[model samples]
Target: MQIDVDPQEDPQNAPDVNYVVENPTLDLEQYAASYSGLMRIERLQFIADHCPPLRVEALKMALSFVQRTFNVDVYEEIHRKLSEATRDLQSAPDAIPESGVEPPPLDTAWVEATRKKALLKLEKLDTDLKNYKGNSIKESIRRGHDDLGDHYLDCGDLSNALKCYSRARDYCTSAKHVINMCLNVIKVSVYLQNWSHVLSYVSKAESTPEIAERGERDSQTQAILTKLKCAAGLAELAARKYKQAAKCFLLASFDHCDFPELLSPSNVAVYGGLCALATFDRQELQRNVISSSSFKLFLELEPQVRDIIFKFYESKYASCLKMLDEMKDNLLLDMYLAPHVRTLYTQIRNRALIQYFSPYVSADMRRMATAFNTTVAALEDELTQLILEGLINARIDSHSKILYARDVDQRSTTFEKSLLMGKEFQRRAKAMILRAAVLRNQIHVKVRGGGTGAGAAQLGTHTWAHGLVSIAVPSPGREPGGADAGQQPVPDEHQHVRVPAGPSRRICTPYPQLPALLEEPLGSRPRPPAWTPV
Candidate 1:
């Protein structure tokens, strides 16, 4: 097949060809210097215009001589020009013969041959850096490898691209260059889903002292590390190392929070799965439960994770409730609830009941009614005892007043009046206690029977438990001047009382004057004075 050459289609043969190459090399050194200066000024068009016709081999040789004898200035200039020229040619249309032009085949072959020759010359220059010695030469070699790797990467040859990058990274000496190489390796490993390799490279990158000393690690690096950690956790989960997996997943979830981008649905699902695994493993829970310190640390690290975790438990609340109901001895509650009583109560009241109570009641209201009846009966008995004690105290006071009033002449009238007031107060107190007990029982019955429902009764119970813990548990340490070292302090005690080392001497102090009583009767008859002590 004969290929026709078209003069109009040939970029090199265009009218601008003369404008592109008008300068010849008379003083090679001076010309190279002048050309480098033009390039430094970013006047690429001038250099292109002055350079000779496409003498590919000669141009490369001149560039090498300029690099060796003069400076990199000329070499960089030539590379810049050549790159621009190549881009321009690529943008131009392929050479085609015009109608009736009938160009010769050799001419067309010569054009393709010339372009290939130029590319080969540049390729050789790129490769020759490998033969040079020293770190400076190695840097050039690294650049060449990087350029080649980019070419391969752009061409979709990931394996070859990785190989080139790996070679370049081996020669990297600067911290910046090393970090770049590590990042490149990480990118490829991630693309390939080589999780183990990704972790290894990340570990190496992070272990570098220079990288460690950096005030802030790069976000991309942190994100990659977070993802690898999560993947490692998933692998452990797959291997049935549930405890280890939970630890890893928890760490990953916490770390991922640093970069909000990692909190995708996939990661959430992974976190949820780890939590589910932990729930199934009783040994893991037992090991973690006693160490309040560890639980605190977990809370600090993953505040959001607890909600998902509790939700997981909420799904299993029915099972826990069933266990509680079936075991009359409260053994199951002791096992699961006592260690985490405060948290369990809150979860039951806030989350578990809110989500499951309706379904539970719908399934069987009779069971709830029975439970409520038992609780109400116990509360009623306690209230009855309290009322009876109050009545007995009031009766004793009344009897004492009557005996004193009969023996003393009009002097015991104040005592009689005080006793009567005490009886009234006791009566009111008993009624209030009875009313509270009755109301509690009614609420319990309503909650259990699914009649007029006690909305959020479970929540109220949880709040009550929280309040009990808050009120009953003593603050961590004792205050000064309040309690003796050997004595246990009361829960509400805020200060300690200190006794001095001196002999026992009572200190007499006057009480503050009380305000005038506005509610007292104005015309009440006065009682005679009782016998005064001498």
Candidate 2:
């Protein structure tokens, strides 16, 4: 029998969800002002939800800004949240005296008026789109669709805005129009929290010939590229691909990063910095983050994040992590960065720990703990985990409180590898010799009787003895293995002479008959070549 357990209920399988921000040192007015449109209201609402200290202030800002748009539903929702937060503040033990100010009453008249206005505008846009379609003008029809999308977006109908924006794609007549349609769709997709759709449209916008061929030379194209990169970075961040997200954000052009509708320049710096620190190695951090000319402008926007990256690169782990901790509250208040804060922090800490012990043969657990600002037991646990994961080639002595790098026997390893290579060479050489012998002998299985049965098969061999005999035979006047000045007597033509075949054997044959044997075949039977040894 198997018991099914919920992953969320299993501590080991569950993700870290302790994302809360308290006491953020953010200037709400300045931060909110950096963004416009739905982005500002949404970011404020998110900050209000996660941060208790700034709940009422954030909600009040969102409530006020939301009124400028025709999103009556969101206005009511923000007001409701503001009222709750105000009541909670009043009931707190350290509550201040009432300042004689209350949240503004629900604007029913404005709500009704805005709803009617939105409906009228939507209908008018629909009518215009139909008229454009009837006229069969592609550009006008595309503009009509975009106008409808804008109207839907203003009224906080993300679904309808997305549909309208996507509909414009079919009517696009040029690369610029297609890019515009894709950007509109991407914006709505982001607002809808549809990250995959955002990434898809980002890719489409980037792949357009106007953007791809023009590169970054054109100011207008550069701005669009920056927006595309930032959107892709957010999608990658949401997907938990920290390295890819870092690369995307780092590619964004600082001067052209004016997409306040999505994120601020300061956000690019923070997101790119933390991601680079978490995933990039020392050389990559130095070469890409510290020395990058384009991204330096972005880094200048967030000095704190810039300092954290420098500190981490300089091997100042304790101070760097401390700064990160101090900034956690503010980062958690961010809508995009909040969910990944804990995971990124953990990865950065782990990378630091791994780098700390990399250059040392052995290190004391106490010193490492102090460097990481953690307890000795915790440090030991982390080291053990790294060792198990093969990130660190080291071992620990529990009683001694020391971690030692494992010794590798290079000489034995080298000898073993050489032996294996030698064996392989010998095997290959033997195979080559066998193959050459088969080809030299012309040996093969010959099939007879035109039959497929094994009984009809016979071995056939062709001797290459004629060429060997011709090369081995010397001139008749000169004796084999004898100097020209030798005084040895020559045997008579009819007499049998003993010729040395080798050191251990001799053959008796008439001197004149030996030359005749070399010119004739020996009875069509396979035999060894006649020996004439030196």
Local distance difference test scores for all models = 0.40, 0.81
RMSD of each: 34.1, 14.4
How displaced is residue 283 in candidate 2, in Å? Answer: 1.3
Quote the positional error of residue 167 for candidate 1 in Å.
Answer: 1.2
- Per-residue alpha-carbon lDDT of candidate 2 for residues 320-339, written as tens digits (9 for 90 to 100): 99999999989888888887
Locate the minimum summed-lDDT window of 10 residues in model 2. 461-470
Error of 2 at 514 (Å): 37
Worst lDDT run of 10 residues, candidate 1, spans: 465-474
Please provide, for model 1 over 261-371, each residue's C-alpha lDDT reduced to its tens digit, 9 standing for 90 to 100.
Answer: 122223333343334333433344334432234233445433333443444354554444444333222211111112222323333323332333323312222332233
Query: Highest lDDT among the candidates is held by which one?
Result: 2
Please list all clashing residue pairs in model 1, or write none if there are none: 481-496, 481-497, 481-498, 482-496, 482-497
Residue 17, candidate 1: Cα error in Å is: 62
